[model samples]
Target: MVHYADPSMKYKLSRLNLARTDYLFSRDAAEYATYILNTSPIKANEGRKAHLQLLTKCAAALRDILVFGQACTVHRNIKN
Candidate 1:
């Protein structure tokens, strides 16, 4: 029982950490996007694209974290 619980606890902690990282990434991405839109010249399409890409990456990371959480839940259920 202890061994089984240990793995589940670890997974839960990992999920929490992933969630926290995702939150920080989202905040940073939003800040960068706002900075680019507000300070960059309208003609600088490249700068806009770069900022958008960063936001996209952050979104993808969040998606992955959610997927991981789902997988962990599924695995835990299966084990039980």
Candidate 2:
């Protein structure tokens, strides 16, 4: 079972369906990494490989978020 040091941490459903009960702010990528790491040992080799693949996907998602933010900023600058 998973345990947390904070008794009152907010819980939310991660993309992997695991309980994420830490962090005051909403950090999607961090939560995804946490879930993957936390569940890495469930099926030994297969689980680890799956987590690695998930990490790759997470990296891509973060990159997309960054690119979108930059695009919005550029658009705002041009509109002014």
Highest lDDT against the true fold, candidate:
1
RMSD of every candidate to native, in Å, equals 16.0, 14.9
What value does the lDDT take at residue 12 in candidate 1?
A: 88
| Candidate 2 residue lDDT tens string, 1-80 | 77767654525324324433334335877888899888667643553454545767533444444443343343346666
Model 1: residue 53 alpha-carbon error in angstroms: 23
Residue 63 Cα positional deviation in candidate 2, in Å, after optimal superposition = 39
Q: Which pairs clash in model 1?
A: none
After superposing candidate 1 on the true structure, give the runs of residues whose Cα lies further than 4 Å from its correct spot. 1-5, 44-80
Report the Cα lDDT for residue 7, model 1: 62
| Candidate 1 per-residue C-alpha lDDT over 1-80 given as tens digits, one digit per residue, 9 for 90 to 100 | 33554668878877999999998899899999999879867863544455646667533344444433343333346666
TM-score of each predicted structure versus truth:
0.37, 0.20
TM-score of 1: 0.37
Instruction: For model 2, name the residue pairs that clash.
Output: none
